[model samples]
Target chain A: MNRKELIGQIREKKSFLCVGLDTDIQKIPAFLLNEEDPVFEFNKQIIDATREFAVAYKINTAFYESRGIEGWKSLIKTWEYLPKDCFSIADAKRGDIGNTSEMYAKAFFNIESSGMSFDSVTVAPYMGADSVKPFLKFPEKWAIILALTSNEGSKDFQYLSSDGNMLFESVLQKSGEWGSKENIMFVVGATRGEDFLTIRKHVPDHFLLVPGVGAQGGSLDEVCRYGMNKECGLLVNSSRAIIYASSGTDFAEAAAAGAQAVQQEMEKWVREL
Target chain B: MNRKELIGQIREKKSFLCVGLDTDIQKIPAFLLNEEDPVFEFNKQIIDATREFAVAYKINTAFYESRGIEGWKSLIKTWEYLPKDCFSIADAKRGDIGNTSEMYAKAFFNIESSGMSFDSVTVAPYMGADSVKPFLKFPEKWAIILALTSNEGSKDFQYLSSDGNMLFESVLQKSGEWGSKENIMFVVGATRGEDFLTIRKHVPDHFLLVPGVGAQGGSLDEVCRYGMNKECGLLVNSSRAIIYASSGTDFAEAAAAGAQAVQQEMEKWVREL
Candidate 1:
């Protein structure tokens, strides 16, 4: 779950891709609803279909959140079905007051606490150190802070000049000190590939959870070109582009094919690493 | 649900307090566990109990997300249960790439798209303008960006120098331009009460969703001193200190009492406005 172990998995699989399990009920084929928990069934099938090709599973809490209680149970069941070697992320962008954040950390990282422990959770750094540090208090549990997101809005403030440097650069420098490279990561959206070089100049060694690939139209070659590190530190996520490849009975197969294509592409990158 | 109407609700309530519905399962009274969906039931009772006294409800998505599907349903149901006059918020700190963010916007603001529509969502402005603009696509919905938080690490990066301006200051000034005051709000932690004065200098007219007032020890008087505008452009939230006021069967009564106390203090400030 730590950086070294995470990197090792990519090296072993020859794939650095983290398939985002942003399973939307509406998006998944209607057939799965026949199962007790449609979301869990869909996730289990996806994990079974793609585990061999993926190094990590990033679950976006929003997709399940839109569903409510049953959705949460499905999320838990999906986590249960995921293999241990593949890193698990809550993909829950959470940050709050220190005391409250401690509870959130307990929920996502502590097996004794929530029963569903994720290796990492995406944290909003806007609340500052206390909000992010609570997640870091537990060693080996990574805090993926939002830096230069690929979204167009990233240009709104991330590039604003304080004097000479941009705002994101300041976030990169200051948040970097809150934890070690082993525990801290940045969410550098894949669309903003060019900024990856600049981002690396700030935190050269930490992992970057590069989202916005595939369905979001971010270029894989460009991201790897500007974002990759010596350790192959990048978890490029593709959700909609892969998971919902088909809406019929062959959906799982289609998903597998989609994952295979990305894995094949990543295999090339891994060998180069 | 939009800013104008939300302002009207605040004026009607003679209070600008938006009690945070961070309904942590363990924190709720054990009696609620007997219900089919304990979190939902707890939120329903709390909403019903506090509806007449408050103008807005800020549901921290983390509490529901940690629980998974069922939690999400609870959040949605809670949203539906709130009085129409009260503004409903998905306190989900979401920001992603352009296309991905478009989906998030659909999930939160657009009823047909997200299934459950919330009036506003809390967003982390780390990614800049594009990440935030996607949220603003909905005419009446809002994008509440993080400005100054109350956490310890707030100093770590939020105040870090970027060129000559503080990073948070740059975020406030730069991000404030992306949308009009109607749709763009800022999250200024109540724990940083006096600092709100400085933040307001940058975002004077926009609304603010202030946390840290109750359980986090943020003083209402201090926040009102430097933060409140003529329109009472503030929705101070109190989560744990109110919702978890007691764990016994008297939980709902306790929550109402807790909410009333904050509302009373908030009313004092509103009278001046």
Candidate 2:
């Protein structure tokens, strides 16, 4: 999806929520185990329940990858079942050398080869510019570069001072030259609080996919206050807090309630804008 | 495999050469396309032909992942077919948050879960300590962190000056505290010329996986002269120069010759050690 279309969905839905489908087989309802493809079945129901509130779906590739071939099958089937109106993200933090990275671009952005083309893929910035520019080559596909992540480890390297700016600040500043706002975005953790203000100074127009809103204790209000742009350019992702709200028979209904509550909160923020 | 076992393999084989299985479908012999799984069939042939001289095999996951589910199947089969005497490295270049990195570790380390147990997996160091420590939780497994890469983009962020040291140097210093030399290795590209001498100052004991030898124009002689330690702690990788040496029916034989030539040069270095 293009930036304009994504912004349109945010306005239409009154939410910039991107539901993360980091679905683990062990966490799902026990009854679903009898199904032929339990992971896909769980994702299908979750997508259906949260489609009304979500502007995108971010599938964490690790959950699917740990299961081997069956997990990969589940990933493909889940990708197929995702709502076309919502942007699909392969939260596969992938990046390599120039030629190798081109293969990764085909894996996520070229559906004909990989059988699933996500609108975007999360890329690690450690390998630098050439490693990331490969994904931007694909038309309408976004490259979400890691910047100031929400994890405790973010302090280890990301916060290092470099040439009058922190490592992540340099990442944002340098990566901005690779692609336009339409094809480039930053993964800024909501837990970073005031760091969002710092991130905005670098790429104010680019979309920021903010994780750690609910389960990780990041406040949506604070993120919106500092991170949101005129285009509602903040994709607040809530994974476990919404999807695993209930693991019993009422899981789907409970997931919907959780999503709706966040959407309703997001509606207030959108209204203010 | 543990560090001792890996060193043993290097000494026993009289070589520290790592054959990179970057098996691209388009580059393989056309005749293999008629097989049940052409990628796997091609890899099986390459592994069988090169197992004698190579001390390790690094599977670049991007090549297989580009093909989706079928590609994943090939990855598992390739892992299964790897010689027990040789070390297995998953050149996945994966890293995430604490919980997410655990999943990636399981995806590469836990054979019971992912049907693939590699000795080590390449991890991007942008996210820092916690993002990398999870991979070390598994006994006998290693986390190969990206230090100074070979690509031109390596200069973008890795060479950034911070507190009298470069970004890559800081990475070598700070990450040195996370894991022991027994469990942690760094990727110091052969293309970086004299940077290997600087890297050895921070990590004198830990192994180094060097890429960009043949196809990327890095010299093996220059790398060995500056990078080799007391135990000959280096796994020099050559992917395209070995795997795609020929596109005809003689592809596997050509690959064997390519691997043998590199192995012979590495044997000279090992003997000097």
Candidate 3:
């Protein structure tokens, strides 16, 4: 989805929530395991329950890849099942050299080639510009480059200071030149809420895909206070807290409740816009 | 394969050559397309021909993933077909948060879960220790972290100097503490021959997976001169140059000849050890 459409969706839904489907087979309700494709069934219900509150869905590819061919099958099915109106993200932190990266771009963005075309795919900027540019070749598709990640590991190399800018800041400044705000977004962890001010200084207009709001203990309010642009340029993701709210028979309903609660909270923030 | 076994293989084969099976469906011979599984068929031939000279086989996951389900099927089959004696690497430069990284570990290392157990998997170090540690959990498995890459884009952030060391240097220093030399390896691109000297200074004992010779214009002699250690700590990879040696019916023979030439060069390097 383009920047305008993404903002419009956030306005209409009154939420910039991106529900992350980091669905693990072991974590799902036991009864669902009796089904042929439990992972897909779980995702289908989660998508159905949470779509009302979310403007985007980010499918973490690692969750599906763990099952091998069966996992891949579930991933393709889940991608097919995602609502077209909602922006889709294949959270497959993929990047390589120019030619190899082209194959990755085809894997995620070319539906005819890979049977799934996400609106965007999360990319690691470690390999630099050529590693990311392939994804930008597709019109309206986006490349969400990892900036300041939420994980503890984010400190390892991301914070290294060079020329007075943190490594992630350098990532923002250099990668920002590779693509425009229209086609590129950055993944800035919500846990580092105040860092959003620093992030905004680099790419004020680009949307930031924030993960860590729910289970990872990132404050949504702080994220909004520091990160939100005039266009509400933020996609705060909540994965475990929303999807695994309950492992009971009413799991989908529980997820709906969890999403609705977050959405209601988000509604209050978007109201100022 | 453990450190000792890998070293033994290098000595036994008299070569430290890693044949990269970056098999693209479009690039394979047209006659192979008539087979039940063309990509797999093509890979089978390439493997059969190259195994004698190669101590390792690096499968670039992007090539398989681009075809989606069928591609994944080919990957599993090719993984199954790989010679058990040779070190297998799922060159799927994957990294994420802790839980997500665990899933990725299972995807590549745990055969029971993912149906493919590779000796090592390439990991991007942008996320840091936690993102890479899970891959080291499995006994005898390895996480080949990306330090300096081969592409033009590597110049962007990798060379960024911070605290008297480049970003890639910091990655080598910090990530070196995550796992022992036995379980840890770093990808020091062959294109940057002189940079290998700097890389050796950080983790002299750890093995380095070098990619960029031949097709990428890296000098094998220079890589060996600066990168090699007492154990001949380098698995130099050549992908397109060796795999796509010929596009006609003589492709397999051409690939075998190409691999042999590299192996002969590698033989000279290992003789010193």
Candidate 4:
């Protein structure tokens, strides 16, 4: 999906919500286990229920990868099932050397080779420019580089100050030179309230994929207050809080309600902007 | 796959060679493509030919993942086919949030969950300690953190000076607190000649998975002189050079000859140690 199309989706839906499908088979309702592909069935229901409120769907690859071949099949099926009007993200944080990275790009962005194509694939930036550049080679696909993650471990290296700037600041500034706001996005955790101001200083126009909202206890209002640009450049993601809202058979309805609540909150923010 | 067992294999083989199975379907001999599972077939031949001289087989996940479901099937099959005595390394540079990282750990380390159990996995450290700690949770499994990489992009943020140490130095010191040398290793690129001395200072006892030997023009002697430790703590990887030595029908024979040459060179280093 292109930037204009993404912005249009946000404007039309009055929601910048990107529901995360970090689907764990163990966490889903036990009744679904009897289905042919429980994970995909669960995702199909969630997507069907929440597509109206969500502008995008982010599939976390770890859950599928852990389950082996069957899980991988579910992942591909889920990708295929995702509403075409809504943007799709393969939340596979993958990166490597140039030649190797080309293969990774093919895995996520080339449907012919990988049997799945995501509009964007989250990329780790430690390998720097070459590792990330491969992802940008795909037309209309984005490379959401890791910057200022919300995890407790973010303090370990991201906060390290160099020349009066933090490590993530350098990631933002340097990575900006590699791709435009059209192609490059940064994953700035919603938990980092005031840090959104800092992230904007480097990437004012680029969309920021904000995790750590519901289950991780990040305030969506705070993220919007500091991070939102003229284009509503933000994709606030909520996984467990939305998908696993209730463990009972009313799971799909409950997920829709949870997403609706978040979308309602997002609508106020989108209107104010 | 523990430190002692790895050293034992190195001593017995008289080499610390790690054969990188970065099998590209397009690059493999055309004859194998006619087979049902060409990638797996090719990897089987290469592993059988090189098992005698190599102590480890680093399966580059990118090459397999690019092929999608069939590629993933090939990955599991390759993992199963790996000689039991030789250490298996999944060169899948994966890391995420703590809970998500646990799934990644299960994907590569837990045989019951993913149908593939690797002795170690190459982890990207951009997500920091918690992301890495999950991998170390498995008994005898290793998280080889990306410290100083061999790519041209390594200069991007790795060399940024913070306080008194470079970013990679901080990665080494901080990650050391997470796991012991038995469970934690660092990926110091072979191309970074004298930088190995700097790496050794931070991690003297820990093993280093050194990539970029042949195709990328890294000197083995320079790496050993600086990075080698008491346990012969180095796994030198060469992919394209050994695997693609000859593209003809005698590809397997040529690969064996290529691995033999590297092992002979490595034998001299082992003898000196």
The TM-scores, one per candidate, come to 0.84, 0.98, 0.99, 0.99
Model 3 chain B poorest 10 in a row by lDDT: B171-180
Candidate 4, superposed: residue stretches over 4 Å from native = none
Isolated chain A TM-score, each model = 0.97, 0.99, 0.99, 0.99
lDDT of 1: 0.80
Best of the two (1, 3) by TM-score: 3
Candidate 4 chain A has its poorest 10 consecutive residues by lDDT at A184-193
Residues A141-240 of candidate 3 have per-residue lDDT tens digits of 9999999999999998899999899999999999867999999999999887789999999999999999999888899999999999888999989999
Ten-residue stretch with the least lDDT total in model 1 chain A: A64-73
lDDT by residue (tens digit), candidate 1, B92-118: 778765555666777677666446788
Q: DockQ of candidates 1 onward, in order?
A: 0.43, 0.86, 0.93, 0.90
Positional deviation of residue A104's Cα in model 3 after best superposition, in angstroms: 0.8
**Chain B TM (all candidates):** 0.96, 0.98, 0.99, 0.99
Off by over 4 Å in 1: A24-46, A69-74, A110-115, A161-165, A191-194, A213-227, A244-258, A261-265, B2-4, B28-49, B102-115, B137-139, B161-165, B175-177, B241-261
Q: Show the colliding residue pairs in model 3.
A: none
- Per-residue lDDT of B42-100 in model 3, one digit per residue for the tens? 99999999999999999999999999999999999999999999999999999999999
The candidate with the higher DockQ, 2 or 3, is 3
lDDT of 3: 0.94
Clashing pairs in 4: none
